[model samples]
Target: MIKREGYLIKAGLLFFFIFLEILSGRTIFLISSFSFFTTCVLSRQPIRQGRAMKISHQTVVNRIIVVAGLLFSLSEAYAAALLPDKQQKVNQEAINPEYYQGLSPEEAYQWFRDAFSESRKSTELFVLPETEEEISKRATIFNENLQRIIKENAESVSKGESLRLGITAHADLTQEEFQNRYLTLQLPAKRPEVLPELKGLELQQRLSALPDSFDWRDKGVITSPRNQWFCGSCWAFSGTEAVESFHAIHNNMTVTALSVQQVLDCTPKQDGCKGAWPGVVMDYSKTDGICPESCYRHYYSMELSCKKQLIDKCPTHIKVGGYASVPQGDDKALQVTLLKQPVSVSMEASSFWFQFYLTGVFKASHCHTPAKIDHAMLLVGYGRDSHGEAFWLIKNNWGSWWGQKGYVKVQKDKVNTCGISSFAIYPTSI
Candidate 1:
């Protein structure tokens, strides 16, 4: 009977092992399988042919407690490795079809308010329409945006397109309002007299060997997405983030969030909050160099005095050698450069479709134009989506609440979707 019991336990464990094998690569799978295997070992000690193997109730409870503790530790360690900054879990349903499906204008507005409220509960980063008048106006605008989203999704389905549209936090505001407040990328009046020379032959050699997909984030060198928040300082954020990546890649240092406030405060020849080009900001960092967040903090477009006295005293984290500008409208060139490091690029982000974009390869050709780039973002990676649509994964300055946890995948196209290929730039030697 004892021998038969051992066979039964072994058989059960074999089935459990098979179950865990199906979930093989995940952290939970390893943790759970190990815990169960350990429990089995503790519960079923070597039994002499005549004597029954026994595990005390207290011992079993103690073993379970130990296993639970081990599981928690392993899970936390895995999570930390993947997300250093500890980002909050994204509520993907907010952008999902089922979340807004079949809701009327009023109901949709309520859903929007509830979504923001829930987000605020966790992050306190969003504000709701408090006054009755404000609430009514926002509801009306949200209704209009919702209609556009519905129409766009319908058009996408009819055209058999992979592109999708959904309501975002900006849905409560008109496109004009969003543009005036958020879309801020302005070119310098005069270009840099001597543009960085593109090494065409060298780049061509590397292009042939380019991987099917590449992401700097995978290398643990890209920091979490930050919100510019009505700050026309995307130029500063993009410049800062690009510098951070370049420095980490070159020096083999861990990715760190440097101070964008310093860029806004210290960069000369431009109003940091009033909008400036990202390349120029990076050029500024090449000389002055930026400090880490511990030394300076971002105020989200709030006007503040440039704290030069404090910044001067703090340790300079990484000083970039210089920056290079990719040839305008040359996306293939941009792709090769991206393999080396993350690149800074600008796009036209004021259109209704672009403003309310939720997920999927953003392929609205009408809104994209080379001459109309109005926002700055970091081109972190590129790859094909599940449907085989090629896309450029860009990190936006907007908070995690916007677009795929503060990133958007633009459809790779010849026309350059949203002029992403136009005015591309990346930092050089650290």
Candidate 2:
């Protein structure tokens, strides 16, 4: 009877093994055959007469089966822990880098001229209207502003040349009203600063320190325009630019696209479309976190409150740090550091600074002028020009349409004024 009971228990143990293999999506052929052989061996063991064996073969078989199941389950659990989670599918169009690339240098110059002409034509249509009262009002104001600017700088504008003013048209105002209002407003002339001669010895030393080879595209560093569209969120855009570069360098991740709305709506310390510092923005990411674009659409305005739950929790692999800034008088050391780590920088009026698309040996702007700076950007890398003059290769946020297709090379140490010299960096992990 004891021997018969042992045989029944062994058979049950073999069936349990088969059940586990099927559930785990593993082949049971080898394990099942081995179980059958082991069961047969145990079942054929001689049964002692009279007093039953203290440890019945049935009890031994049941213990072995449980142990085997536990071992397999543990192994599977370990493997699952090692695997990376799958990323959600995102549209390639949404994050495509090529969308940002601009025309070749020659083609870009032509595009800029064409774009400027087109803008002037559009402004002309709005400046002159059929209404007599409106047309007369606009003409008076327009003539006054144009006369003032030309009178102030007659050399810059030729006789009979039309003066182009930068102005935005609003829906509430008629074309004539908008033009009149714009012209009446005081428009300050940009005082061009004449850069002093930089010491050749210092410049040469800086040039020697830069790496000879660097591929900007492979490094995921490119210039963009300084964009301002109905919002004073330059701070949000600046912070996002730094975050994007840091992710690319340290995490080996590149998303040419980042939402300014994410910074505007989500970060509590920052008022939506208002302004905030990069430091405050980083702190928000620690708590609310950042989500992929699919999870959240870009939003602005006080009417819609940001939902924090949409963002992903911080990844264990990524390391966070404060914005990196270069130390004063350590430009050479800073240049070496930048080659290894990209940093975020803020300059007053980077918009106009990048306007010239100045390259090779060019004059630097002195700070004596009325500053139009209210922007920040990234310092990706640096290299020497054909003449062996050093230049800081910078990326701007203005669309690819502007400035050498969204890039500018500044004289290395010329405009290191107003702590514009500072840059933020993420430490590398080996």
Candidate 3:
């Protein structure tokens, strides 16, 4: 019979205690990882039958503790190598290069996951790496982007600047691809051949009756933030949200989220996710009205075949006379329209300033060329800035992870900063 002694007694007792703790504790995986099967080491003295003998239980337990400590230290060191020195802070739910430097492959992937929350099913669609080579390439790209942005932002900061850079999800794509994907704005038929400019006197007169401050979002007229994902259906979102707000205010009912998927899928006038004209979207709303988001809420970034059957079972429709054009190049007219309801406006959102706009009323002098009004967004409210400068509060469909939680405030006095006032329009109720 084997008699328990020395190392055996100590190890058995230690394991027994650990077992009890495991029975009564949290994080069983951590505790269980420490656990291992029985093992023996010979004492200085030989055992019975001239063979080496069992270890002292104390020695066994001590050895295990030592090994466990070594493993823990190694784990921490490895993690330190992969992760950033520290998690950097930001105004939004974004991860900038300032947050970390020299991140490993795992860390880079984790960073993307942390900020963008890209699903496992959709991993193949994004720039996530698979092979070892791919991982290295991705890490290099990630760091390059971070360093570039950080350096540029530092220069911007030195100038006593008002805007800052951000590491948006679109940071990975080339500017050309990004523009094509995100800003798919094509003018819809039959509005105007030319948008004439106006003087401030005319603007002041048009906006004379407007309130000093107004925000449809503040008044519960807008929906919660939404993400367009890989889809360029901001046109769909822009028009639908305006319709949503109009229905709420028009019917004197509680504001509810409406479906852009209806317009994305059912409308023949505009392409589904490739891009859409908000004007056509408004026309769709004016004719068919829109389904509530509750009735049909599937916004995979990919476009699908139009489903008229789903439109048949829609929940609510806002009866509208037709789409009304807000005089282009008129901020005051846009403001007047906003005071009553949010307007669907087209703008050139494909600029670096827009991609990384943290806060402050964005100025037009920031960019090189006036980009085409490539994307559409809702002009929800207007108010003076902290310094008494006026700004337009606009809603975005890129989800709350971006800009002021899926919204932006640009300088209002400038008639065409990113072409905000150049292509403004709203739906009129019947």
Best by lDDT: 1
> Candidates' TM-scores?
0.73, 0.47, 0.71
Tens digits of per-residue lDDT for model 1 on 1-430? 7667755754565455445444332334455556655655664532213345466786567556545544564564456345413323334566554587788867878887766554332222346768989989999998877777888888988997777776665678888888877777897665432233455676677667878999989999998888776658888888888999988888788888888877887788776667889887778877878888767754435446779887877876568878777776777778888988899888888877677677788874757444478899899999999988899999998777677778899888545677887678888775
Q: Per-residue CA lDDT of candidate 3, range 195-294, in tens?
A: 2222456556755566788888777788877777667888888888888888889887789887776678877756776787787777787777777776
Off by over 4 Å in 1: 1-91, 101-104, 118-128, 192-197, 368-371
How high is the CA lDDT of each candidate model?
A: 0.73, 0.44, 0.66
Model 2 lDDT vs. the true structure? 0.44
**Clash number for each model:** 0, 16, 6
Q: After superposition, how far is residue 37 of candidate 2 from its true place, in Å?
A: 72
In angstroms, the error of model 2 at 82 is 44
lDDT of 1: 0.73
> lDDT value for candidate 3?
0.66
Task: Judging by TM-score, tell me the better candidate of 2 and 3.
Answer: 3
- Flag regions of model 2 displaced more than 4 Å: 1-209, 212-216, 221-228, 299-304, 312-319, 350-363, 369-373, 386-389, 413-419, 423-430
